[model samples]
Target: MSVPETPSTSRYEISENPEGGITLNIHGNMGAANAGQMIDELTALLSDYSPSSLTVDLEKVDYLDDFGTLVLAHLRKLVTNGGNGFYVINSSDKIKELLSILHFDSLDEKMSIEKKRSSGIFIRIGEATLQHISDLKYAISFIGSIILSLVHICLHPRSLRTDDTIRYMQRVGVDGLPIVALISFLMGLIMAFMSSVQLEQFGANIYVASLVSLAMTRELGPIMTAIIVAGRSGSAFAAEIGTMKISEEVDALFTMGFNPVMFLVVPKLVAAAVMVPILTLFSDLFAIMGGLVVGVFMLDLTAGAYMSQTIKTLELFDVFWGVLKGGVFGVLITWIGCFRGFQVRGGAASVGQATTSAVVSSIFLIIMCDSVFSVILRYWG
Candidate 1:
């Protein structure tokens, strides 16, 4: 009959012609669960009659999920990469929505999304890093203020010779001795035992004394003492000054015509700078003695040999430089703590924040300065 011919109900229709090679049209949902079987059938068909071009007519696609989208993408890529062509014609809005979600709208223009992601991730990170650097810079500027304060006092010699000096010395030096001794002794004992285990293997047990003395005098002693006093005395300085600042006592001092810097910052600053090295020296001596105990008892090295070797290896410059580094770190620690405390806003929260920031930032600055000194010593010493 010359009646209208009905379209084939087959999901895929293939045709071959004498003039051209082959064409395939697929219709229906070939999502993840069914995409595998669909691809297998399509590949089998393609192997039999390798087509020069493939056109997928998606006009009748009711919907597509991730699987169906992936199936189409892979076939398109294969044909395009093999010097063939792939075309999608008459896609429905429903299929477009799925493709859009997979970011397949413009396959060739995806560098922009990658650029956006890179910006979004690392740009925020850069801002955070810059903020930290700014905070550190502000802390460094505080050191300049201290130098100016010293120059002012230098012009007026009467300022340095005061009871404040003696009182501050007692607080920072004598009051700090017990804690320094305890920490140093324990540290030396730990280092000696740990080093002994390794050095004993090489039958160089006597070198344990050298290791403990060098480490204490050169590195561990100064760093550890600074950290302890920073936690102990630095926090105290902040809280005490912050309380005075909040309670209007600092205002009273100004009203009485007494310079608050001389009464407060100068005393604490001088105290920390002077006594931090003393504490570190104490730590070095105690730690060395602690290690000596282990050397005599376990390593069978006499106290005379241990002490002689220690003196022979340790230069006066090593001890002096360590103390100087301790002094510098101490000054920074106290200044920041007091400055942070004085700059506090609000109430208890601000106090807590200042105290915590003082400790954490003091530790960070201590570490940074240590690194700088290490680098300098590597080249200079």
Candidate 2:
């Protein structure tokens, strides 16, 4: 049987061979313009006749492009998939070279794609352990660098970046004041109101001022301030240094005979250490005022009596302890932030990850340190 050409740019004649296989004689251009229609028509013919084998004669074809190569590949795949032989013949040297270049011979073979197997649990555990060890080594090295930098600055006071330290102080302290104040005030108000509910039942409403003052001066003040600073300044420190790290600015500093740690980290560390305690002191004061507001209005206590109770309840040691904790938390925050920044690799995405890690690590360390302090205080008191 002979098949006539359709409106497609490519034409092909299918004839049943005497040997019981079908021969496809292709004519005209076998380029992208007719590749789709050619594949569809050829596929339908092959399916209808269910030929035992297919022989594609490319001798009459005028031109063949990559898309045409695809049409040939498609037919080869279909025939082979149906357990029949697919053969290409009667090609000019040009067509033969084109097919060879396109690796048309390999088109009939199935591709082997190896899928990766999941690692065993023990292998994952080993990897995690090694990663933690590597991180610990880096942490120790960074801490040592920080200490050496501090000593160098101490020995040569003028070597310190006084201007940068001042700038960071303003950024960490002054800029953070409003939010710190608002949060501390609200915290104090809530504490006072809650304590008043219980104390009022026992006619101990006056103790609300004492409870608010003691908590703010000893515990809540430093912890709350540190958390806020971690979220704001800690993330900023990581992002700033991480960007510098990825841009090779840190390397540039090292090449210029500058200690990257001293140049970049020291100023931030000093600023945070100096300013955080001051911020905590302010936090305590604002919280006291919030409690006073609650005491005077809700508890119907005179402002003078509330102030007296607060003053009488709080010792100077309590204020000093909170400030001390704030200073420690400040150092931890800046150190972790700068360390995470230095750990950054690759591009902008790494910087964002570093910033997030810095905040989370700082907060975790702060709470952990606070717990230790609580244990020590319990024993000491």
Candidate 3:
């Protein structure tokens, strides 16, 4: 090794070692005053030389500050990233301590890659299949429980709570009358107006009476009334019973040797079964009145003529089937509501979820059963 005189300016001496590596010796004060120059010189050296390994000699450096430490750290990073081994030799204790605290010595060279899993079609299909099977089982259990309860009530009539049943009927039926009538009347008006546009083209506007009457009696009347009751009474039943269940009142009833189903559910079921059909009849009448408004005003038909056409077109079986559909829908709404309520666990949030579920489930069942009725009536009639 040859000793060289101290230099006035910051500079570097690059040499090719016989041991198959390159050495860069930095001399003079490496501080903020000459940090930029040092970085520029290092950048030029990297462009000029291609070395398999690099050894940096820092022993000749007189002083090193935070900025100079940053430059050296950046240069070390460059050398290691170029597929070469980087070594720092003859570093003073102060320089080593500063670099150690800056975490430059702990840089990880290995890259981390994330692996993603693909969602396959068969996996999704299998999950859906299992969910549907679970739902079907739940439905079967609910239906069985309802049937057993009803049969028990039939065999033991005196055990039925008539007062509770009447009270529920008043709440679910009489209180719901004005809104149900209003909606049915609007629906009939819309149906009559829309149908009359096409019917009037052929000068057959008189048929609007028959169209609204038959549709209201056989299909719209029961369906609309049931949907209204499901939204109103079903959600109420779920929320009320769910609150009771959550508050432990239902458990108290059970502890007192009372049949919760017979006491709580049967009255609701009976009330719904009794009131819904009556509501359906009222819905049909209101809807016909609305159709009469369109007929007498828009179609310029006589009230007598409209009533006569409606009477002639609407048969006894049409009203019977509509009322039957109403009864079935009522039972479905009440049972599902009470069932969901009984299923409640936890707090008020669970009660709210149960109430929402009851309404949604009742509506779905109503639509499905109505479809089945349509199919059966098509074939049977």
lDDT of every model, 2 decimals: 0.80, 0.92, 0.89
Order by TM-score, highest first: 2, 3, 1
Of 1 and 3, the candidate ranking higher by lDDT: 3
Among all windows of 10 consecutive residues in model 1, the one with the lowest summed lDDT is 1-10
After best superposition, candidate 3 residue 218: deviation in angstroms? 0.7
Task: Give per-residue CA lDDT, model 1, range 159-244, as digits (tens).
Answer: 77468777877887799899999989989988999999999999998899889999999899999998988898788778877888
Pick out the ten consecutive residues of candidate 2 with the lowest summed lDDT: 1-10
- The lDDT of model 1 is 0.80
For residue 201, give model 1's deviation from the true position in Å.
1.2
Error of 3 at 251 (Å): 1.0
Q: What stretches of model 3 exceed 4 Å from their correct place? A: 1-138
lDDT of 3 by residue, 239-358 (tens): 999999989999999999988888899999999999999999999999999999999999999999999999999899999999999999999999999988988989999999999999
Record all residue pairs in model 1 with backbone atoms less than 3 Å apart, i.e. clashing.
Answer: none
Clashes of each: 0, 0, 0
